[model samples]
Target: MTANPARRSETSRQAILTAAFDLVGEVGYAKLSIEGIAARAGVGKQTIYRWWPSKGAVLFDAFLALMGGGPGDDAALPDTGDLAADLKTVLSATVDELNDPRFDEPMRALNTEIVHDAELAAAYAERLDLPMRELKRKRLRAAKEAGQLAADLDLDLAIDLLWGPLLNRWMQRGGPLTHEYVNALVDTALNGMRQGAPG
Candidate 1:
């Protein structure tokens, strides 16, 4: 009996993504190659090239999915009115995903490649980072609109204030991306960055 074409394609796609994750993790990102993922997934070189142009693209897609923000889901973000609480929850989830063994290799692949490959960096920024920035920015702006804080605020700066520190801490490995550390980050961000207290 013949299998369904869509099902077969999905199976192949999933296999390729999984193989990319393992290869990027086992070998450093620079060492990862299309030949490697194709071989690991038991697919032809053309199969990978046909779907994804570069290892960075594959890695970005794989890790973003692992982070619960994949397959065009990057536009999704939680906004619970309380900016502090919302950011804390979202960033904490991000921390958990980053620290997961399943996610470690692919994320590292994406992050490192962005440093050296301008094209890949641009794609990654467009596909992943911009969404993250938008999500956080929207939440902060909403907080301001709700009169949760003062007016005439710089929303981008506000996002940077709350979001960048956690990212900085993680990228620098300043400390464990622990819940305590993340909560501290959220607290520091809200207290230090908020424009003014509510009346």
Candidate 2:
């Protein structure tokens, strides 16, 4: 019987992504390399280059795979009708994820790569950032309809306002990422929007 090339390719791809994900965590991104990843995955370096343009790209895909995010995955935020509560819930979970030690090194590494690599940044924005933002917008849009937020709120700017501080704090290591902090951020952002909203 002939081996199935498609199945074999999928297996190799999975192995490579897993290896990249694990290696970045174990060794940190500064020390990660294509040769190291290939050896860890038990595949040729060519296989990785065949699929990804660089180590940063590989790491980005690996991060996405680990997070279960992709083109077709559900990225919805909680929309329980209470906009502030829902935002707090979602942002609190984000705080937990950002503070998780297992994800700390890898996330920092990915962020660093994104900052320096234009291609990887573009991929991250398209595949992860935009989708997540749209999902958030969907939740906020619902809240707007329910009179919880401004009807004319700029959803994109609102998303950024709610999330930007948290992200900046985490990336800058300015303070602890806690649920309380997330709640404050949610409250503050929502309050500002509501005040500007036409009653």
Candidate 3:
């Protein structure tokens, strides 16, 4: 019996992603390496190199897999026609995700590097942040179309307002990340956008 090429390829890819994910959580991004991942995955280093150009790329793919999405996929966010409810749901999940030590520590390590490395930050934005933001923006645009938001909402500013405080709380360690806190943030941002003049 011959092994299916597609199945073998997928199995190897999954192993690499899982190894990268667990290694990053345990040893963090700086200590994570292709050799370590290959050894852990029981695959040759050449296998990983053949698919992904760098460890960062593999790690990013792992992160995407962890989020239950693929590169540039944003289907994780639900659309229920209620902006406040939807925002609260998503933001609350984000709060919980950030609170997980496995996710938090690795993300912090990656973010630290991105902060210092402009090129890496640009790549990260292109690969991760921009797609996520565009999804959120799409939801906001839907809300505007439904008259749930002001007609002339400046979506970029609206997005910043929606996420800024949450990001601040996450980065500054100024407050606890709670469902209640995310709800408040959503309310405040939505109310502000409703009342404020369009930019």
Candidate 4:
């Protein structure tokens, strides 16, 4: 029986990602290093270098993996043609993610790195934020075209308005990220965007 190189490679890659994810949670991003991850993952520094350019890159990929969606999934937002329901479902999932301890601390650490390092911030936007935002924007544009939203609705501003407060509350530790709260957020955003709503 011959050993499979491809399977071995995948195993090594997953080990690296898991090590990075765990280390960021344990040591925080500022203190994490390639050498530390290599030691934890039981691989040499060359193995990590073969796959990632920097610790931030590794951490970003790991975080996305932990979020239940890798960076390459091209699926669009669920469009059952009901914008309110879709938005509520998405926001409700976000609330659950924010409330999960396994994800919350690691995400907070990565966000802190994003805040302090401009290069890392740009990479995060390029890898995750911009793609997801564009998908949501596409959905919003569809809603507008379908008459579910005002024709003049600014999709970009609408996205900010819909998600900004939730992000603030999640990141700032401001309040409980309850399912009811996310539902309210979706209703408020949609009602404001609906036709004939007061500005």
Candidate 5:
């Protein structure tokens, strides 16, 4: 009996992605290489190269795979009617993921690649950022329709105001990314936006 070619190829791809993700966490992205990932995955180097153009590309896909799904898959944030509580819940989960040791190094490496690689940046924006931002905006739009946010609030600006500080703080290590911290952010942003809403 012969193994299905498609199944075998999928297995190899999964192995390669898992190996890349684990190696980046253990060795850091600067020391990670296709050969090392191939060795760890027990696949040939040619197999990796055939699937991914560079180590960074492999790392990106590995990160995405570990995340379980890509954009458009789970497109909604939890909308529990109370916008503040919902944002706090989601952002708190983000803090946990960012602070996690297993995810920290690979996420940092992916951000670095997105910064320097134009093509990767475009792919990331198309596949990840845009979808996530749309989810945020969808929630915010719901709140606005409910008169919880400013009638004229620019959803994009609102998104930035809510998220930019946390992102900056995390990337700069300027402060602890605690649930309390994110709750505070959610409260502060929502308070201001609510105040700005027409009475």
Candidate 6:
């Protein structure tokens, strides 16, 4: 039997999402709008509105989908049991992803949206940042449990250690994302900012 027409409609919906994602990545979110998305997707404005409430919603979902975080789905962070190792594995991959020329444009666009639109910022937090942050927390707690981390170590501090340098690296273009760089991050995080680990 042939596929249902609803499935075909869903396919077109996905096509619209793809077009929005690509166009926003190319032109930037400021220039991206529902009308522009329609033109790019070859769909009608009403058709876009039939499914989404705003351009921010579409672009937010589009970026998530591109990141393998489709509707009702969350991206996996990593759970390899070895805390430093697992964090290293996931963060190393993230470093490489962030450093990619392909990702920079969309990320900059999304960053702008985060600042400009309160609703979009909330949507982005709900869909993307919070889950990733929770995953990082879970891993750090696990590391504490495994005795790989100091029992007195603060998870919040651990999280800062994990993300802070990466943020600096991206904004400052401080350095490239490399195995050596990631290893150094892990070491610096575990060792402390100004002093060596307790002897």
Measured against the true structure, the TM-scores of the candidates, in listed sequence, are 0.84, 0.92, 0.84, 0.88, 0.95, 0.83
Clashing pairs in 2: none
lDDT of 5 by residue, 106-173 (tens): 99999888999898888888877998899999999999999888888889999998999998898888
lDDT of 6 at 2: 91
Candidate 5, lDDT over the whole model: 0.89
Give the per-residue lDDT of model 1 (tens digit) for 100-161.
87676667667778898898888878877787777767777788878775677777877777
Span of 10 residues, lowest total lDDT, candidate 4? 66-75
In model 6, which runs have C-alpha deviations exceeding 4 angstroms? 1-5, 70-76, 193-196
Model 1 residue 161 lDDT score: 72
What is the Å distance of residue 151 in model 3 from its true position?
2.3
| Cα-based lDDT for every prediction | 0.77, 0.87, 0.83, 0.87, 0.89, 0.77
The candidate with the higher lDDT, 3 or 5, is: 5
Q: Is candidate 3 or candidate 5 better by TM-score?
A: 5
| Candidate number with greatest TM-score | 5
The lDDT, on a scale of 0 to 1, for candidate 6 is 0.77
lDDT per residue as tens, model 4, 1-199: 8999999998998899999999887887778999999999999999999989889889888977775654356668879998988988888888888797777877887787788878889988887899888888989999999998998988999999889999998888999998889889889878888987886
lDDT of 6 by residue, 89-181 (tens): 877887877877767767767776678889889888887777777777777777677777777777878888878898778767787768788
Report how far residue 134 has shifted in candidate 3, in Å.
2.3
Evaluated at residue 7, the lDDT of candidate 2 is: 99
Q: Against the true structure, whose lDDT is highest?
A: 5
Each candidate: RMSD: 2.9, 2.0, 2.8, 2.1, 1.6, 3.2
Candidate closer to the true structure by lDDT (higher is better), 2 or 5:
5
After superposition, candidate 3 runs with Cα above 4 Å error: 71-76, 116-123, 195-199
